[model samples]
Target: AGWQGTAAQVVTHTLNRMQDEFATNPADCLAYIGTCITQPHYEVDERVASRLPETHLKPGGKPGKWMADLKGANLAQLLSAGIPEAHIEVSPYCTWADNDHYFSHRRNEGTTGRMLAVIGIQNKPS
Candidate 1:
């Protein structure tokens, strides 16, 4: 139940199926990024939480604690699909953490001034 029922569940299942169909290595990943890890230094939103195995919160962490367990599970799923860990890359700036750089809907007071940042391998120029 680590992630079979969580949002990451789709990622794992999808990646596995993609590898099986395309006969590609996980290193040839077909996915994107994860979530923002709960940092002690950051005053994250504790309202976001998950079930034990489905959560990245440490043991004994309260329900109000922030969690990115699904994100971690997604990474593992990609690796299991044959993608190398080295290929995975993520940044807080893409999440709600970095408001100034990355527009956050909530932090921006539901303003439409948020920036859309996409992460993926750039295709070679034709």
Candidate 2:
């Protein structure tokens, strides 16, 4: 099966860093695939959300694609965890817009193909 979602990259970077720091030589990573549901700019959805005291997002439109916000937060967390910024690479692929290339659970409505990434780690022996 193809790999799914953008989280896979982050997952791999994290694993790779851990393996290196722990002197594990090399390591491998698995797919980080799952459902992702966030606010869409649909009129009806926005209208309903406006009435709620607490919302899925802040008042002024969506916050820079909260999915991306979560990603940025994840990036920060990983950095705090000792992973360098230069070591981590995040794709700018937008699921909703890059449907032609990347598979989107939302755009394809559960019938989409996934993309996979292959990482190899040759652990150093202690």
Candidate 3:
């Protein structure tokens, strides 16, 4: 399958799994971290666009690869799962593709290292 189709399947499956998992193991809050490449829509190929469910072909940035609001998409998913907007947090960093701090598949052409971000609440002291 192409990247576009793979992305769509992953997002849909992940969201569905999250909904099921949260029902049995609910968290007080959720955090989403990653870089959403900010660019013009023209930069993204039709196949890429078709895979993304939250892409808006809006203008107002670089000439290509219109900004993809991953955070917004995640928020929407969370909201649909009954998670309030206020309970979710999004990071501002753009990851490796947009920044040197992280590894980007686009920048390195699938030869980049992986960056992981983990989240969990610590037990409170009585």
Candidate 4:
């Protein structure tokens, strides 16, 4: 699938699952995703920053793309879903727009060479 289609599908599926989980246990239905940095002309609203403790706003690096808080956007989503302000956690590092450690879609000028890291835990019988 194309990027937009894939993203839409993932979001739709996640929302459906969240609704189901919330019906049973509301507290268990938390969603977290990394958001792309937007232009500074767009405001990073206070409802987001209040929850995330480690949001950074880097200045004057790129022309159109300003350093934004991905975790802040996620925290804002959680807060909008009625989750407590203290429950969310934000990373200290700026993902793409700031450091070279992470690949940026914006910086690459629409290149398809992005890398991602995912972690999970497996259950073991004791």
Candidate 5:
């Protein structure tokens, strides 16, 4: 879902897909929680911006542009879908701001190395 479209579209589409998974398997959906990278200054078309909340959006430096909060938008979607706030976690790191520790296609011009994170539940022996 990397820059597939405007932040609004990406967040909405991603939440829809997650909701589908939740419907099929609520337990697994809860276990598969994760966060989208924060986009402090994501520019989007006015049309897209209009669909997002004003609280999660900021005026871009130029006209007809917007800075979106992709993380906050995703979080709100999870909350609306009944995901507990305690079960959800948001990373404070911004890839662009933490270029030394994270890969940011926008900051690095798509020349950065890949990064991977994995989480799972280990069942107790029965």
Candidate 6:
């Protein structure tokens, strides 16, 4: 399903909820991949659009439609929640725009898709 609220709201709520149960902070570092700010994927209510950051919203091609910057919104929320700017890295790629490199359910009309995520810790030099 699509985002229930602005990306900022969704990200903030999720981080807060995770913090409640996790022993460590979730805002230490963030790496965003796919679905970049370049894609105008949201058509939201004006009230919700008003809450989004300036860089995170733009006029959609059609009236009453607004393109939202998903990654920008999440980055804003993470920074507002005390995460350092240096610790956050946002990818320049957009899954919706790059069909050959990424899978997008919306672009494919729910026919098929795949998810990939990777995380690792580097070993300290002796």
Could you give candidate 5's per-residue lDDT for residues 15-90 as a string of tens digits?
A: 5665565443223345232333465646777877787777778888889988877667666766665566776777
lDDT per prediction? Answer: 0.50, 0.43, 0.51, 0.43, 0.62, 0.62
Model 3: which residue pairs collide?
A: 35-94, 39-65, 39-66, 40-64, 40-65, 40-66, 41-66, 43-65, 96-102
- Per-residue lDDT tens digits of candidate 3, residues 61-90? 445444445455555555655555676666
lDDT by residue for model 1 over 1-126, one digit each (tens)? 123344436656766675677664566554556433223322224333433243355433454555345455556656766777777764433335655555555456668463443534434489
Locate the minimum summed-lDDT window of 10 residues in model 1: 35-44
Off by over 4 Å in 3: 1-27, 39-42, 59-67, 96-98, 119-126
Candidate 4 displacement at residue 96 in angstroms:
4.0
Off by over 4 Å in 2: 1-21, 24-68, 124-126
TM-score for each model: 0.54, 0.48, 0.58, 0.44, 0.65, 0.65
Query: Which candidate do you rate higher for TM-score, 3 or 4?
Result: 3
Worst 10 residues of 3 by lDDT: 33-42
Sort the predicted structures by TM-score, highest score first.
6, 5, 3, 1, 2, 4
Error of 5 at 11 (Å): 7.7
Scanning candidate 5 in windows of ten residues, the lowest lDDT window is 24-33
For every candidate in turn, the CA RMSD to the true structure comes to 5.6, 8.6, 5.2, 8.4, 4.4, 4.5
Give lDDT tens digits, candidate 4, residues 9-126: 4434544565675552324443444434443422333443333333344443444333344444445546656555565444444334553665455566566356554533233479
Question: Per-residue error at 29 for model 3, in Å?
Answer: 3.6
Q: What is the lDDT of residue 123 in candidate 5?
A: 46
Q: Give residue 64's lDDT in candidate 3 (0 to 100).
A: 41
Candidate 4's C-alpha runs over 4 A off are: 1-16, 21-24, 29-35, 38-71, 117-126
- Cα lDDT tens digits, model 6, 68-98, are 6766677777777666788777777766777
Q: How much does candidate 4 score in TM-score?
A: 0.44
C-alpha lDDT of candidate 2 relative to the true structure: 0.43
Error (Å) of candidate 4 at residue 51 is 23
